[model samples]
Target: MFTDEEFEKYLKELDNPDLSEFEFFTESTGVKVYRRYNKTSGLYDYKTIGGIDVPVDTCFAVYTDLEYRKKWDSYVKELYQFEEDGKKGVYWRVAFPFPLSNRDYVFVRETREFDLNGKHIYVCLGRSAEFKSKKEKSGVVRVNDFLQSMIFTSDGNGTKAFMHYYDNPRGMIPTWLINWAAKSGIPGFLAKMVIACNSYDKYLASKK
Candidate 1:
């Protein structure tokens, strides 16, 4: 779904060392969050870095397994994969607190493995996509603008992970919700991911 030049651009941004444009948002659950303004969207983009004491493969699996994600992620109201015209896509519906409408997204995702400088890295890239066969549900806002990239690499006995995320959840959003996303939402999700990674082997065995 992405061109080679576009992928290279993403890699360049991931490799960028200039943190002067970003401000530290929070640090919790072994993850540090940073944010920078996106002039194009008039919103903020997030950068997250952390280490999990799990194998790199396990961590990557936990992040990519949609079935397993439904078990660990409470915010995931619905998630599944589909194929149309020989292309694969993902649909996700996120649950919001009371009185607020839920949000959904359709994405085209790709995963790549690279050996750079003798270090093995796994990257997951995703962007919003339009699928003619997918229909939107009533009362749920469709998030058409979303981008995410995750990088996982071995760090000694553990895995070092980084994420870059941006999305425009089109609709009316309150200040409190925005604050919660930055402070509690992201870290809480990562914390649950760690737990999921720990049990991923058992989960896989159950499937066999």
Candidate 2:
């Protein structure tokens, strides 16, 4: 869950962000990424804009299906939901290349729908939170300072996606790793997501 102020601020940013404030990072396979410096975290905040050749509803379904994601996204080492002290959140562990420790996150995510100028928009937001049931593992970097907001809307026969991403992966990050994330990691994830969305229905059917 998010605070009212945070909700309002994120909505404004997603609805209308000043491009002048961000520097172009990279574009891959039709997906464009921009980044801006964050003084507080001493890290960069990224914006991903792209068009997916899938319906908005399908995109939402695929994005929210945590279990289904594990089947397609090979980068996810571990992912699941947990509830403790009457509060619930998700736990995620991501794989990293050799010489770098894996990264983990504990966060709560929410989805909302809105109508702006007669257009439907779906937003999925996530923020880092602590859970008594979850603890950091040894040799794994915990990403406690993280925020993600993704917007999805119909674009003709396809869907348009806008995502704002920020996270402190903890420890030292090499310049090459950052560049790889921008040029390949982000865009590659999106590309795989489209394939997942297209096959989500079949994935669900197999479960039944």
Candidate 3:
């Protein structure tokens, strides 16, 4: 735990961050996340799935539970037919009931969840939000259009997460606005992932 002095020092650093401090390093997973404010257009982020310690495999697997999702994850409702690795599935939009609520839970129609042929993204049981995988996507990552791509890499140690949001808004939004949204939203989303690991730990300990 950080002491009061240590916490103050940390806050001071955050206030006037060193650019070098923001630079990405080689994580055990070998995933490179370039964390930065979108100076040009969009935002990029690098963060652990959960703020606390989480083994990667433990993190990814828990991301698939269709029910009991609300216990850890914030802004997603019930999931339907959401495949783990195939390509596509369904999850509802949801809203959290508090300030700084990480997940933006809002239930949407199944049809709304997908495209003309159910060709899109929806939700993840745990890992990260859904999106056009550039390969596959569903609920959270799958916006009405291309929004952000949240990717994960797992090595023996743990997982490294990355996010890249399109710079410009589709309908009427501008690039900076969209980037701001990405910056504002991504951190909390990443931090909330701890719920998954913690919940699993509780489950395992209970079984023992």
Top model number, TM-score: 1
**TM-score for predicted model 3 compared with the true structure:** 0.42
Model 3 agreement with the true structure over 66-179: per-residue lDDT tens digits:
454656664565445445455454444454333322222112111111122322222221223453423322422323322333333343366544333332223334555554
Models 1 onward score TM values of 0.91, 0.90, 0.42
Alpha carbon lDDT at 208, candidate 1: 100
Stretches of candidate 1 exceeding 4 Å from the true structure:
9-20
Worst 10 residues of 3 by lDDT: 105-114
Regions of candidate 3 where Cα sits further than 4 Å from its true position? 1-52, 82-88, 96-143, 147-153, 164-178, 203-208
Residue 143: error of model 3 in Å? Answer: 4.1
List the candidates ranked by lDDT, beginning with the highest. Answer: 1, 2, 3
- Residue-wise lDDT of candidate 2 within 1-208, one digit each (tens)? 6666765665666547657789999998777899988776666888988889999899988998899989999989999988888777999999988889999999998888888776788888898998877889999999998888888888878888888888888788854567556667788889899999989989989989
Clashing pairs in 1: none
Residue-level error in angstroms, candidate 2, position 113: 1.4
- Compose the digit string of candidate 1's lDDT tens values, residues 1-208: 8776755655555446246889999999677889888776667888888888889989998999999999988889999999999999999999988888999999999988777766788888999999998788899999999989888889888888888888888788854467566677778878888889999899999999
RMSD of each: 1.9, 1.9, 15.0
lDDT of 2: 0.84
Residue 131, candidate 2: how far off, in angstroms?
Answer: 1.4
